[model samples]
Target chain A: MTTNHNRLTIHEAHKLLKSKELSSVELTKATLERIHNLEPKVHAFTTITDELALRQAQKADEFIAAGNSNPLTGIPVLVKDNMCTKGILTTCSSKMLENFVPPYDATVVERLNGRGAVIIGKSNMDEFAMGSSTENSALFTTHNPWELSRVPGGSSGGSAAAVAAGEAIYALGSDTGGSIRQPAGFCSVTGLKPTYGRVSRYGLVAFASSLDQIGPLTQDVTDCALVLNAIAGYDTRDSTSAPQPTPDYTQCLTADIKGLKIGVPKEYFVEGIQPEVAAAIRAAITRLEELGASIEWEVSLAHTPYALAVYYIIAPSEASANLARYDGVKYGFSYSDTKNMWQAMEKTREHGFGAEVKRRIMLGTYALSAGYYDAWYLKAQKVRTLIRREFDQAFTKYDALITPTSPTVPFKIGEKMDDPLQMYLSDVCTIPVNIAGLPAISIPAGFADGLPIGMQIIGKPFAEETILKIAYAFQQATDWHMRKPNI
Target chain B: MKLSREEVLHITRLARLGLTEAEVDRLSEQLSNILEHFEVLQQADTTDVPPTAQSIDLLNVLKGDEVAASLPQSQVLVNAPRREGDFFRVRAVLE
Candidate 1:
């Protein structure tokens, strides 16, 4: 019961729960025990709701008994700490909100609760989702389950690591700049960044409003589709949410990609990519071709090289505006040892935020400052327009683009921490999709030196089904997704 | 691209952040280095391209002006660091 129940995927658990062969309470307990056992090593969660989970599981069992079950019913899932959960801590792994609990849930949490999904806990992340590694988390760093010494790629590192380690059946992660996909790649999990506005961001603590997107990190592609069906749709609460209709994503998961056109962007396969990682992705491309995806090798998005520069300017600029709410008045951390109101506010932020958070805030303030606003912020946004236009042009010629999710596999914990520039470059492959507002999925492709590698499939705006179909087909022919770390 | 100490201090003031001398010194150097990376943007030709504040095309989404249920004052003040009855307590703003 202990070993078997915790390892079951959402799809597998759904079958067991529906058949009455395994009760949700039993499943929840087993999962909770696994989380407790692994918490010391992985440090995946900021808060574990074992009591809340049991109560929710009991309700889920009653719902299942009444034949009112859904795909996520009775499923134990973890959420990244950035999303608010009513009466639960939503810290964003920052000291600024370390003791903060919200009075309302994020829209995604509400939807998951509506589906009878048992909330396991809030996972850790970089402070305000600013860095590429979980090392910036004010709480603690989440280690890659595959190798404890190596860092799990982040700021969604805790979500990816939890799913990989079977701490939760699946978890929700937000991607601003490759936060979801890069960590999913590092941990060998299946992750998707839905098209911008596909999911509501109403109660998500904003990092960069335009680029931030909430998506799933799961064990396999089928589970990804099932979770997407439960969460994706228009929300009147989030004005930016698309008014387009949400389809049953499960219908698009057929393991058949006969005539799909897949483009390989040359810019993604640049000089910095690890040799084995490139070879693994190239091999996956060949496999897709064998399974009937026509691969075009010479695709070029000329503006790709400038995405990093554009993202740094644009994300921080938006973040500076979005983060001004922590002013020591309404909620979260406050500093009392100050002379006046202004001094109190200033000291609150200075002491509450971590180094990376402060760096981004300073960078943003500088970029958006009066004299330099046009030269830095405005220029980056215009370049962003060019970058988006390039992806728009590429999508017209091909159904979707394929690339390596990250340039390399997971690195040792302290390897890239000292150099911020070096750490930012780790996400080079996955950043452009967010810049263009496209849907992208990262799936397990292969392994190098016992570490996992991932391949990314990016689709047109509101074209999640197309990318899911391709990823589903590729996942069917590979055994990489089936392999688990011996942790 | 190098930001002088005065420039860093000026930016911090605008950002409303209080920092120690050590942080100020380290940040001036680090911020300058990151800015050096942004120099590449000047090379790109974006003559007539408009700045994209958001990627999605939706604009001016209007809804009926209906008052929705609001959180109770107690619930809203539950996480406040300091509160006086219904109002949040803070250092004196008006001298």
Candidate 2:
């Protein structure tokens, strides 16, 4: 008895539920059925909660029946597996925590539950959110919904794929360097990576605590706004969270950008971008200009070339420290074959972590070592200040900046897996935003060779409203965000 | 930019990860390539700039000192790979 509820966005479903034309239970059932059918081809979810979703759906029905309907009350959602779900397996798609279930909910999870968002399952990710392609997952690889042979972008590939496949209404993903936006770009969905401290990261599995941020992946800009409204707020648990009042994100979606000043950095449009991807972004820029938003093409983010290098040094350096807790005791996997505890810990890590995770740990350890500290880690941090300053200066003249989310469209699976350096370049365009701790959103620009190309709108620190308004205008004038994959 | 075999082994020791001989050889080449990428930071001329450990400016967030509810002991130890009487059991530290 699945209905036409699978493709409804949060805004569309809200009106239907409020008018007593639909129940949350029906929407949940259809979404669960879609997951059951498409999961074999998409491989999006690591775990599917059928019983819990049904129970939550019934409660959402009750809440709506009592006339307390909010934007998210009946919406079925998916969260990346990195977020701790109480009593659910929260593996980061690594063998290290394959069976580890958390005892508490992440702050984002708690906030969503409070708003009556029905979480259907946890999505797959790169091991410890380390790589650019979902192939880094030790358990399984998530294929793009558009092309079953191609990859969904990493590390939040599963969440992006799920939303693109209509397996969920909206989903949440974490971005360290473009985990959310890159995958959403590849899968042709909308995703936002809020300003560095916009959301609390309390129960999130740490990859690089300083850079990691949690955000939403949705079907449209409207749904993205609703999901952001539910999840963005401050919490005392995370010291890095900025103590600021969150404006209603959905309130800004009504107005269009008429006289908005958008900056286009010349450095981002370099030689590496695929010709088709470049063409689509150019057309999108033209469309924005036609819609009355002025675009400046001479902005220079001079330090763009150093972002990837700095990220590699600093992210892995923080990873080496954040990942130190996975020793063979207290939780997760442990090796007990050896009698000595120290050797056992070593063996457990050797057997538990995947190659990508191990490579990062080793690289980090060497960079922070005695002779290399001043040359690598500390120098990278100083260069990070430079990159941040570039964005800070650009925002003074522009309301928002536009750039391609990734250099190229999504490639086939296993194409870049063998070359780690090539894989590292997948995040080249998106990493600088994380370094600057600014807000950005990726929306579907158009298709390139039948694959999606994403264009990002970046705003100043804590200025999520401006970017969302600009993106909403572009999305209204274009139908790119309406296209769904056939999976 | 090249990581030697001895150096790879030493770094693994510091990281407390035991890699087989084949794993060491492969990681040395890969880690060397990765390090060569980081060498560009030397050209950045960050002579007078300060290091940024965290991006946000807020710090020293202190919660109230009053006692709050903690996780139950049963839930905390539920996922332990090996447990004995509410304590995690691991291989002996000393011989």
Candidate 3:
């Protein structure tokens, strides 16, 4: 048994399991022990399923003994708390669902289990996946594994932190607006936000139904592809799930990007981007060019600047409707102190939700309210069309677009907590991809002041295979993905 | 684009949230700042452009009417905060 089995990637673990060189039980135990030691410093998980994981690992070992093991068969993974897990406490880091044990598994979780993946625990996230930093979590903040004082970028902060800290081999995170990629960038891991509708969102707790996507955060581009292959596909339960057939993602990870046309959007290199991050991204693009991929410097996405504004309006409006279901009756927190139903519901929300949740609810409510609906929600929707059209046009001339995943490196834990707009601005480069319902990946580009920077590759809708090929090639050319935090 | 205290209160009521005076005051300022940032949308020319509620080309998805196994009542009601006899219980809506 390898003592450092916790540091093994899914591909490495699979090889050991298949060759009878290691058992899933040993790998799972190593991972759980690492998680136990690091939880105090990282605060990465909301709930740890040690027993469930051991049981699943035992089953996976049996599968491997029978020579039926797959890539993720014996690998332990962490799930972001927003996804439902049968009989497991699936809190979205809000007091509202803090004790909410789901009755069934999310489609992605079901898919993971079907592939014999052992789920270790549920990682914390921003309350309702609403904030850029996990500081907004009602439970606790997840620290960046690289720097304890800095935030693991959110709302998928905990998942990214765990993967970086070697607490789990990989993790699943839902990205509404850069939730997965931003944190991955901060933590220096590889994260991919699959094209909208590429992965089923059936049991994912809704923040904004149209914008939310479930994706993988992994140690490398290949592991990201492996996790994606397991989770990506259509389901009848999710009406928006694309009916398109999923390709064997692992086959797309060929370390070759010859003759590929890549574009660098001038809009993403806006004024607020830190010079170090900009330089790292430029270096990454130059590397891609050296890899024989054609690079375009003059590509323009004219409506890119308006994505943040459009996202705030549209996401909140949809959230106001999606979150209305938490009415103290159905399946979450409730207040029974009052006799009147209305007062009880109001008090439930007041006590159950954190400040950021209330702020977003209010913002969404105001946007969708009668008089302001057209000005805010409808106008944002129109602008959303323009943003989508821009990507559509860009895809015509280029196979993919590259940008810095986060404008700045990981910030201090509480730096932007009080200033929502400043927090929102950090997602400027990533929000446009969600608005366009496109696929994007964030890979370790370089580092600045000891913190990691990520370069994002955006692809056309339903073109995950194309982006994965590009990311795999870049990752092969650079050794950044192999760097680990000292935590 | 600053919002009034009354407007903030109205939004809270519409959203079914109760807040302390301090929370309301804080939110009024914070929300106003966010809304002010959103004013950039005014500069966008969306004239004659169709609104996109969904990004992909998905219409009504029809499933067969055949009966399938559903969650048992005991399992479905397990997570309810207040329940009685397989039904989620809520406070009285009328006097």
DockQ of 1: 0.86
Q: What is the lDDT of residue A300 in candidate 2?
A: 94
Residue pairs clashing, model 1? none
Among all windows of 10 consecutive residues in model 3 chain A, the one with the lowest summed lDDT is: A1-10
Candidate fnat values, all: 0.89, 0.87, 0.93
For model 3, residues A1-487, the per-residue Cα lDDT tens digits are 4558988999998998899999999999999998899999999999999999999999999999998888999899999999999999999999999889999999999999999999999999999999888998999999999999999999999999999999999999999999999999999999999999999999999999999999999999899989998999989999999999999998988878899999999999977999999999999999999999999987888889899999988888888889888888988999888899999989999999888888889999999999998999999999999999989988999999999999999999889877889999989989998999999999999999999899899999889989999999988888999999987
Model 3 stretches astray by more than 4 angstroms: none
Positional deviation of residue A376's Cα in model 3 after best superposition, in angstroms: 0.6
Instruction: Please give, for residues A232-331, the per-residue lDDT of candidate 1 as tens digits.
Output: 9999899999999999999998878999999999998887999999999999999999999899998998899999999988898888888889998889
Candidate by candidate, in order, the iRMS in Å equals 0.9, 1.1, 0.8
Q: Lowest lDDT 10-mer window, candidate 2 chain B? A: B86-95
